[model samples]
Target: MSQNSGTEILRYTAFSADPAGGNPAGVVLDASGLDAAAMLAVAAELGYSESAFLTGRNEPGHDGPPAVREYTIRYFSPKAEVPFCGHATVAAALALAERDGPGDLVFRTSAGPVPVTVAREGGELRATLTSVAPEVMDIAPDDLAEALAALDWPAGDLDPALPPRIAYAGARHLVVAAATRERLADLDYDFARLEALMHRLDLTTLQLVWRSSSTVFHVRDPFPVGGVVEDPATGAAAAAFGAYARALGLVPDTATLTLHQGEDLGRPGTLTVELRSDDVRVRVSGTGTRIEG
Candidate 1:
């Protein structure tokens, strides 16, 4: 761990090679000595959308680094702890890759075990994380209406092809698609109402999306529950959206989709999502860069 000002917090940006782009995440490679409260305090001080802490690792003989590369990871937002966070996972994997070289790593998260593979893509390092078995469930009519009201969006503004549903990969998210790009661009919501709704529904973010092509989509995540107005780039929500799209038959059994996110926020990043015919789990890949202080 690199200590600065008596604290070891590493900053990285996921889904983009440029430090100015993508979603920034704080990563603590070694947090074994810190408790949950201390970890949360660090995350809050960083004020990123999410922060990752490597609380434990299975190392043989107390070696320099684990040969198996299995780690116990925890994610925390400025407000509370979350089951999983994709951007932070990617950031952490890239951080480890810089030290341990590119390879496979497994993270034992609160939700489940997430396997990540890191490799050099072109001039930058990229990480692909295979999410836990995803599930898509119907949204209650009342809940859907309430969510729409919170966003001040009418039912008519929704895309008929993409129905509203609740999807879970590592964390729960409400997937809602707009009929037009213009509608998706205008995002001004009632933070308190949305936060309350998300708390009641146990949601991390609202995956607001618009399809620009058969395989290209634009997405935005409202994360009032995380104490962030909006997530610049949300990898967890992208994975859930992939499951939602596949369940709706919007994509083929095996396909690749590109998600363009954070453009409106000026931190544009690209996320590549892959779905296999035999595997129910979704794979999301993106490059990450170390954020300079």
Candidate 2:
């Protein structure tokens, strides 16, 4: 066993019920003593792209049900701290569910308030997170061209239907819809260039997508900013993409969007995005399993 001093680390893969699939993240149940530097060190040691540090709790004798859990949660990558993370959120929710049973959970993040719900459906336990209000914007032509060049992809490979836009729900991501599955599958990009651009634009990841159907899409996220080359499955980007589809009238008023991700990485996972007619906060659900220590 390796000698290290810190909080107990639990490993789990989010968005997939199997341990082999989805995005793996380190979960720290309580990070009371750990500071920012300590958290970063722990995440670097784990090196699972992103790790969650859970700090604080609801006041002892507070209001009924506790709408606000008062968590000073932080997300650390191998290099630095991020404002928010999607797959890590799912992992955190499932971890909470294992101990507290299936119910509603509130996570107070650096970005904003995130509400997650867990329920048992058959043998699988599904966790759904309701994102903050979402918004979308146009991508600058020069930026788009540079991004395409870095990916070694031609502009013709882009989908005309979905187009390109910068989307934001809990965090910001640039949504670029590819014309074909082949275009989406091949993901070799200039890491340094993309990272520089993302840093300049204040982007979390590039939400590269391909529309399989009106209600089905395939997604791959490039997260150079987080010090990860690619994210196997990204729940926060999904929420932002869902909002993009709805706002642009790409899908029906009430629809179930199935996202197939991580196939190219050999860690296939599924994410279900539900868009409601009345509510703007998108619901993203998926299954996760604990990774053996």
TM-score of each: 0.96, 0.96
How many angstroms is residue 9 displaced in model 1 relative to the true structure, after the best TM-score fit?
Answer: 0.6
lDDT of 1: 0.94
Looking at model 1, which ten-residue stretch has the lowest summed lDDT?
A: 1-10
Best by lDDT: 1
Report lDDT (Cα) of residue 197, candidate 1.
99
lDDT of 1 at 100: 84
| Residues 1-293 of candidate 2: C-alpha lDDT, one tens digit per residue | 12248468888899998999999999887888889999999999998889888987766465465653445678888988988888898888888888778888788888888888888988888899899888898989999888888888899999999989999987899999999999998889999999988988888999999999889899999988888999899988999999999989999868889999999999999999999999988889999989987
Best by TM-score: 1
Q: What would the per-residue lDDT of candidate 1 be over residues 126-171, giving only the tens digit for each residue?
A: 9999999999999999999999999999999999999999999999
Q: What's the TM for model 1?
A: 0.96
Full-model lDDT for every candidate: 0.94, 0.88
For model 2, the run of ten residues with the poorest summed lDDT: 62-71
Q: What local lDDT does model 2 show for residue 221? A: 93
For model 2, state the Cα shift of residue 287 in Å: 0.5
